[model samples]
Target: MKAVVIGGGIAGLLAARVLTESFDDVVVLERDKLSDEPEYRAGVPQGRHVHGLLVRGGEIMEGLFPGLRDELVRSGAHLMDAGEMRILNPLGWVASGRSGMPLLVVSRPLLETHIRRRVTAKIVDDAHVTGLTFRGSTVDGVLTRDGRIDADLVVDASGRSSKLPAWLAEAGIAVPEPEVVDSRTGYATRLYTAPPEIPVVVAESLSAPDTPRGGIVMRIEGDRVMVTAQGAGGDHPPRDPEGFQQFLDSLRGPIAGMLADAEPVTPVYLFARTASRRIAFEQVTGWPGGLVAIGDAVCVFNPVYGQGMTVAAMAALLFRRHSDFSAKGCRDFQRKVAKTAQGSWVLSSNADQSWAGVEKTPAPLMRAFRWYMKKWQVALVHDQDIFLRFLRVVHLVASPATLMNPVVFRRLAKYSRLDPRPGRRRAARSPR
Candidate 1:
């Protein structure tokens, strides 16, 4: 059996790696020349932005590539204790502390470079995949600019601008309408020659109504720092140095001040195409077999949330679990891939949709859910237990369902608004 993967970014490399287990031959067709140097691969527009590997994502990657964490550290990746990172949210800030989950902080390119080296598959770089070669619903192989590379299965790990849908339509397959939520968000990132003493992650992401922006400064590999300024809902970050500094200064807290003295080493990189997009492949009646899509090819979240890489890892794992690419098996895997994305979709889109300029309004239930989360955020500021739960859910270590459980519900009840009106204290209600 043979498998061919399109696009050689992190998702495609991981998918190709996973296929090596079940297929006799696995080929990764990449449009960009896969360079040995630790730098951004072409076609990955967001590769220059800030990225994080969630706790669960770290575990899965390590399992797939053993000693990969140590290898990353040896190559200057910061093995961060997620619990110890500082997070400044609109409701309140989470002070640096310790937790059980570890985060591997590295640049997207460096991480991908190492993974690609370990993939052990036949990597054909500079080979652009034009479309799929179909034989009655089952993809027989791919059509590249060079020639046809036949395979039993073809996996689309291509990023957001995937042409797979068009290719599929040509092959007589129709996918469902995509769900999209645009916040008009943008980000500006610049690399600084800061020494290695920087925090593993310095993030300020909180979705209070009308708060349209945030920022972060974290250490990536190579002993340098990446400072990213975020803007949403018509508040776009500037791409020039002076304007970028002003935008950073406008952030909610002191992260901007932290970089006032750091020496910059790269030009400011701007990315404004941050939108939440998802396609329900399982909903497509008679979804084609021998073909599957993962990563940004399936769902692309706002990069500010740092959910893409983690979600891609989970999807690759899901593909491995279902192994076969037969009609029924493909359906089952697509549904599971959609299911794996539900948590991130709910978490990111709900927050992005809350922005003032974002057109889509949350449903009544979603609004109520965010209200509960706002209260929970306030609770998380003071209660370690609540904060830990928040950490787990955000890192994908635990399900969002845990937040609505009785234990958490009771805790949130204590932090409800206590009428700040003069001389009047609303009766304090106990948990039901």
Candidate 2:
């Protein structure tokens, strides 16, 4: 069997790696030459920002490439027990305890390099995949600059700029109507020397309705810390030193002071194209066979939430189960992968809609759910067990059902009397 993968980003590399295990031959075609070192490339615009490998994503990566976690640690990435990290939510300090899962903090480029090294397939660089070449109802191959590369299966792991839907339309297939949710958000990021006093992963502040400003500082590879500040709507972070420090100061408390003291390593970098978009490929009818799409190509989320790469890994793992590297493989794979992405998509989209100035109102259920979640957040800050349960769902290690269990519901009920006024201040001090 022969499998062809387009795009060399995390999703593409992951899918190709899995393909190598099952197919007789696997090839990856990338428009950009991949880097042996950790650096930004044109294909990935958000590479400069902080990226957290959730426990679930880290576990999946370790399963696919054994010893990868240890290798990453040796490479200077921080292996952090999630329990030790401090999170400041709207309610108060979420007490630290064993979270039952661990998170890995590393630069995005380094993580991509690690995956690229694990997948030993034939990589054709500077090869632009122009279109999908189909024969009748099944996809036969892809047309690139060099010509067609026929394959039994073709997976489009291309990132947010993927033109797969248009290519499909050119092949006489109806492109699915994508569910688009836009949150006009921006982020300013920079590298800093970690404070000698701070030793673990810390999420200083997360945006809430009252104060929609958040920032993170974590120990990444090379003993450096990556700090990112995010703002909603058009509330962009300033690039100048004074303005930048004020922007940090605007986010609740303490983190700004801590960051100001940390030595700066890189200039402040700003990025804005943060929107939540999900394509409904599964809902489309008469989809052809032998072609599939994965990763951000299927659903691109707000990067501030950090769901893109982790869910991409989970979706690729789902595709591996349904993949057959045959004529009907693409269609079958899409059907299954769509199911896998639905839960994460809903989780992220709803979260993105919770903010103001997102230009759209949350669904009725989403609005109510957020209201209920806020109450739970207040309770969880005081209850360690409840906090862990909520953290499990937020990290994608567990579903929303876990948040509704009898034990958690009991806690929420007990803490309902402590609910603050609906419009009260939501920001709190750092849990650390």
Top candidate on lDDT is: 1
Q: Please report, in order, the local distance difference test score of every candidate based on alpha carbons.
A: 0.81, 0.78
What is the lDDT, from 0 to 100, of the residue 21 in candidate 1? 84
- State the lDDT of candidate 1 residue by residue for 100-173, as single tens digits: 78888888888999998899999989998898887786778899888898988888998898997788677677
Where does model 1 exceed 4 Å of error? 195-197, 206-208, 418-432
Report the error of model 1 at residue 148, Å. Answer: 0.8
Q: After superposition, how far is residue 91 of candidate 1 from its true place, in Å?
A: 2.8
* Cα lDDT, model 1, residue 109: 89
Per residue, candidate 2 scores C-alpha lDDT tens digits across 68-179 of: 9888889988787776678776556676688768788888988889888888888887899999887777888999888899987888998899998899788777876777
Model 2 worst lDDT run, 10 consecutive residues: 420-429
Give the CA lDDT, 0 to 100, for residue 242 in model 1: 93
Query: TM per model?
Result: 0.94, 0.94
Write down the RMSD of all candidates, one decimal each. Answer: 4.9, 2.2
